[model samples]
Target: KVDQSVVLAGVKMKNPVVVASGTFGFGREYGQFYNLNELGGICCKGLTLHRREGNPSPRIAETPMGILNSVGLQNPGVDAFIAEELPELRTHDLAIIANISGNTPEEYGIMCEKLSAAGVDMIEVNISCPNVKAGGLAYGTKPELAAEVTRMAKAHSTVPVMVKLSPNVTDITEIARAVADAGADALSLINTLRGMRIDVNTHRPILKMNTGGLSGPAVLPVAVRMVWEVANAVDLPILGMGGVAKGADAAQLMLAGASAVAVGTACFADPYAPVKVRDELAALAEMQGISKVSDFTGAVKPW
Candidate 1:
């Protein structure tokens, strides 16, 4: 029998399939479709220090191979999540990764402390949010800013900390190395590529935010490339994501160097996407005569 279990940065998962943040929404909605314990982990919706109303209407739009969203991080504050959501999530057998976004390093530190004390298995820091004190530049775009956030989160959190890297940057490895040096235990990459669409008839942008992050099969190649680059550059374990819809796609990322993979946009089309990917991945492992799924990580040949 193939061992589907994977150990990512000291956290053991039953499998390598995890649902990405902002798409899984605490796993309550998708729980109706299948058993939440079937997958490896769940990165909960992005949380801030306070509740956010999010952007105006028409924040989501359909693109050719994916979707663009500027949901503006609409979520209940961290306090509410700890009180109302974490308890229910604890009942599941999988690892619970809390994804947090903040406008400042101090804010990230505070949330990390709160979430870690609340008993999350790990913390996924979302540095894609604009640093309000830095003239609105994304923390993930600059190595110093990214390191600052990582350091602060590391200082405050008791559990493992994973920094999510943005694909908008010119060199993702620089940010990855910076975070690794700053004490990040793991990394998740290719948060979302910046993209936009316009209505030819109305002469207006489709999303209310004018532009938003693009996610879906459209970004798979870029995600794989970045994951491969960062994995080669840094020694930290990676939780790779972007446009993964099938077991083959997940295997591609694993072979590229990701210790684990996350299913995103595809979940919108099919709530069973994560479980399906997990089962198919196990089948593929068995067919390959591989006794363990974890052996797929960084197994790609560069020729």
Candidate 2:
């Protein structure tokens, strides 16, 4: 069997197929369906400082070959996560990654402080989310703001800290390097691209939110290119996602320089996508004569 173990940010994972944030709720919901230990890690849903009711009705809109979501960083707040969700989540016995968001830098810091004490394996700051319309996209698109936020989070976090980046920026590498310089342990890309869909009958926005973040197979190629660029620019470990739907799709992201692959939209269709990806990666590694999947990281064949 080809070796798939990866030691990322001091977290030794069995493989590199982690469930994306927002896609997988705090383990309890999906745990009933699959064995959580089978996967590498869990990037739980976007958590805020306090419990959020979330967006109005119709938070998710289906489009041709894609999905648009405005989840609005809804959560039971950090305390509830630790007091309630974390206790049950710790039962999974796998590396746990918390994806966090807030309305401002101070809020992000507070969340980091609370989650740090909760003994999470790592924290992924969800700076790319656009649905909240506050401190979400503001921190992600600008290089300076992204770095500042990364710096503050790293300051407050005791464990590994990763900044989830947005693809809507003109230069992703610039922001990647900034985050790395600000003491980020790793980076993840690309969060959902900004997209909007209109209603044919009413001619208004389909969702009451008006706009949402787009993700799925449609954004995979762009995510690959961004991963390739960021990996070359920064030496920090990179987690890649956008439209990973299959084993080969996961492999492609790894070859593009992502140290690991995240399953997002793919999970929507097949709750078993992560399992399938994990198996496919192992099989492909053997077929390619690669003893370890990390050996192919950033090996995007330059044609």
Candidate 3:
């Protein structure tokens, strides 16, 4: 039998296939389709200090090979998640990760502290959120800002902190190094790339925000490249994600140095995406005669 376990920042996961945050809404909606415990882990929807109504309608627009979303992190406040959602999530045996977004560094620290005290397995700091304080430039776009947020978050949380990097930056590896140096225990990348679409006849943008994050099979290459670069740049473990839709895609990411893989857009297309990726990874590992999944980490051979 193959061992698909993955140890991310000292947390042992049953497998290396975690459902990406924002894609899986606390696992309640998908739980009706299948058992949530079968996957490696679940990163719940992005949480904020207060509940948000999210952006206006038409927040989602379908692209050629992906979808653009300006959902704007609509979620019940963190307090509600702890009181109502976390309990239902605890019923599952998989690792529970809380993904938090903030408009300021202080909010990030506060959320981290709350999640730590709440007994969450890990806290993923979403630095990619457009900084409301900085005129909308995302914190993850700048290495210094990313590092500062990571440090603030790490100082407040006792649980392991993972910094989720945005792909909209000039050099993602630079931001990755910054977070790693700021004491981030682990990393997850890359967030959706910024994109836009215009209505041909209306001569207007498709999304209400005029622009949104693009996620799907189209971003796979970019994700793989960034993961490979960051894997070589930082000592922290990485939860590679972007456009994972199948087992083969997950395997490609693993070979490129992803300690684990997260499914996002694929889940939107199919609820069973995460479980299927895990199952496919197991079969591939067995075929390769590998017993442990971690063996694939940084296993890629250079040309």
Q: Compare the candidates by lDDT and give the number of the best one.
A: 1
Residue 200 of candidate 3: its Cα lDDT? 98
lDDT of 2 by residue, 216-238 (tens): 99999999999999999999899
In candidate 1, what are the lDDT values of residues 243-289, reduced to their tens digit? 99999999999999999999999999998899889988899999999
Q: What count of clashes does model 2 give?
A: 1
Q: Which candidate model has the greater lDDT, 2 or 3?
A: 2
RMSD of 2: 1.1
TM-scores of all predicted structures: 0.97, 0.97, 0.97
For candidate 3, what is the total of clashing residue pairs?
A: 0
**Deviating ranges (above 4 Å) for candidate 2:** none
lDDT of 3 by residue, 148-186 (tens): 899999999999999998888888888998888889999
| Full candidate order by lDDT, most accurate first | 1, 2, 3
